[model samples]
Target chain A: MNSLDELTHELFTFFNGFSSWENSVIKTSELSVSEAHAIEILGTHGQMKMKTLAGHLGVTTGTTTVTVDRLEKKDYARRESVKEDRRIHLITLTQKGQQAFAEHHQYHSNLTEQILSVLSNEENEQLINLLKKINAEAF
Target chain B: MNSLDELTHELFTFFNGFSSWENSVIKTSELSVSEAHAIEILGTHGQMKMKTLAGHLGVTTGTTTVTVDRLEKKDYARRESVKEDRRIHLITLTQKGQQAFAEHHQYHSNLTEQILSVLSNEENEQLINLLKKINAEAF
Candidate 1:
């Protein structure tokens, strides 16, 4: 493979490894990938309405509705009405959902630590800098 | 945040960016995420049996069966009985499936190029080296 192909291969290999780790972590829990993602967003950003959640998830409100329905059925999240507008509902994670999100976050921390263990201090700094630039510009 | 937390945040931010890009790329295609994943695996690894494909996807054989069913119905892939083992069948991508995989690969290359554009040559090398170590040992 050429340089570009080599970079692409390694990039994807890393992404796939992370993806599998994430999927397996979610599999061990009672949440599907989408549900876990919703919980993570709700846990981190506090609470939001359906439209905001949909925007964060890059999915349609219709699809978000189905995911929220499952989350509600499982008691991991709830949609509550505001006093001012009964029609507007904000999605909130239940205690169980919070626990799940915390566990997911812990898993992320552990994975980051694992990744750090394999790199020198200087390499870790490089990685952080590189990711910050890519995250800001590449996407 | 501490150093560990900083690394954790940056790591996940990068992972999420890659995930969103991947999902959007798959969205623009005529395949669902799982279907596109199956096609990519089949196209990249050549024809394989259901069990192998399931192993690669980190999903169950039953789930693989459903995915393959959709692929077959969509005429993107097919299962063929091998001469050596009549009971065992290998999943093969159709021409349409190959085209989708090629498109997906092109998207990956495009993303890689975009990511590369934001970094200096040395930073790119640092990323490749860091990713190599992380991919080899982190997961």
Candidate 2:
């Protein structure tokens, strides 16, 4: 295979392995992977408007609405009208949501440590830079 | 933030971007991402038993069965009873499935090209090696 082909194939395998592990971790929760991701984003960034949250998640407002509905029903999150603009709704994680987000973050930390252990400190830095470059310029 | 924390955060964003792009590409099809993935695996590896396919996809036999059933209905794949063992089913892509697989591979190729365009040849090689190391040793 060509260099590009080889790289792509290896990347695909790596992602597959990582995602399988993620699925197992998220299976422990009542939330789907996407739902848990919404919680994580809200927890990290604090309360935000529905549009902003949807933008970060790269999902449609409709899909985000459904997700927020489920979170609200589970008491993990709730939407409140913006004080200045009652027409706008902001979504915030509840205490339970914060707890779930913390657990998920810990799971990621453990996985990160395990993966980073395979590389030297320098290699980890290089990987981070490469990922940033890809994210910034590749899309 | 610490190196580990920064690395984890970047990786999460990278994956989220990639998956959103993948979802958009797969949304044009009748198949879900998992179902399309099953087609891709079968297309790449040629015909294989259902159990083997399930193992490769890191999904349960029941889940694999549902995906394969959808593929068959869509005329993207077929399950053939092994002549040696009537109870055993092997899954293979049909002609249309092969076409869809080719399209999906091309899509990945385009995305890979865009991502790799940001890196030098040497960096690409290093990245491939790093990914391989992670896959091998990161569990």
Candidate 3:
């Protein structure tokens, strides 16, 4: 590849590295990263079917089942059979689960605060706007 | 909190969720995400000392030692004593290691191509620029 292509590739790799590094830090959370992600989805969407949750998490239903099993074992999640569809299991956060989600949110808030702390208020706003734009495009 | 505050909080959570999801996908690489990250850094810097590598990876020296041990065992990396500074160990990638890094790079290339397939050229450029800005601010 040419020099510019190589540079772009390097930048892309660095971007991914930053993301990987952030995940490593988040793994230090009380819950595993996948478990934490499951909680966040449950917390946001309220009760959701196992299949739906798996789709949202971009993992297979089997992986979601294992994650839910771990969360349920930890008392952070509960599964209820849907009345209309016995085959569908709806998962929700227990009170303990809600608390865990709140703490996890706080962790993210602190991280955002730390990241924005270095920038000016105007820069922070720009950063947020840019992130939103990028996310929209990514989706 | 007010509605705006709540919305901001939700945005933060969503951003973090996306990050976790991306990390999970990247972890599917042959190397763990952490190992992949270390390799990326090594590939960029050519060679580095154990302490420097540990500092760059944001892990304890002992943990870095373990990771390096595994990488070396897998023949992706090697550790050499510095002639001038015998106490310091320099780590560098072997040809096999470079091939591994190249393969990892190809993975990202495929991801980027997939992303671009769905996005306009302008949107792709915007996404890249936005990511660069965010990394500068966050790191």
Candidate 4:
């Protein structure tokens, strides 16, 4: 059995590597990391309330408001008030935002492809399964 | 074969889930996320120069100097001058910093243990090896 200490060390090493890789990729993009993340989330999950977007981003609503405002100014996203709730603003990505998201996503796809290239098909399946299990419990 | 889009989507979903999990864990810690990260990196890798620490933390050296200053004030870390180079300072964790690092490490270990509990011994080994391979190339 793998000791907890060993497992933790390995987990952290992988975490650090993954983060650095992501950072390097994000650095190449035109959008700031935060902006790219916001656009990615909106693109993937579709429109959400500003508060909900903040929650998903793990940022304060005020910070989310500022980011969304910037996105709006850049024509990357838009804020709309629902008929039932003027107090709540639904944030949606603009066509330009969708394009940015798609471009940014290509970076992730390329990285994932490179990472998986070394594994056989069966190994790839096993790896994905293990990640799925761990994520299910961890999340 | 997983299409690029499918692979990218899966990778991102897993990334989002992992980040959210880490954020929740860090939120419960006494130190701010950045502070905790500094201590964790120091604790993991031993003492380092401020520039190197900032590199690992993915922040500017000026930002790191400010953070190290706060950590120094809090008695979590200390800076020492080397005999050959008085201009260069090495930052090391204090006893308090080590304790916090240990405590924070427990959160990671616990999460890892929970995730690994469901996997078989062979599966665990495979997962670790796969992570190691990916990390080596990705880093």
Candidates, ranked, DockQ: 1, 2, 4, 3
What lDDT does each candidate get? 0.91, 0.87, 0.72, 0.83
Q: Give fnat for candidates 1, 2 and onward, in order.
A: 0.96, 0.78, 0.07, 0.54
Clashes of 2: 0
lDDT of 2 by residue, A29-55 (tens): 999877988998999999999999999
Best by TM-score: 1
Candidate 2 residues lying further than 4 Å off, grouped into runs, are: none
Query: Cα lDDT of model 2 overall?
Result: 0.87
lDDT of 1 at B135: 80
TM-score-better candidate, 3 vs 4? 4
lDDT, model 1: 0.91
Return the candidate ranking by lDDT, descending: 1, 2, 4, 3
Show model 1 residue runs off by greater than 4 Å.
none
B71-117 per-residue lDDT for model 2 (tens digits): 99989999888778998998989999999999998888888888888
Clashing pairs in 1: none
C-alpha lDDT (0 to 100) for residue B26 of candidate 3: 61
Question: Could you tell which candidate, 2 or 3, scores higher by TM-score?
Answer: 2
Q: Quote the lDDT for B61 in model 4.
A: 95
Top candidate on lDDT is: 1
> How big is the positional error of residue B129 in model 4, measured in Å on the Cα after superposition?
1.6
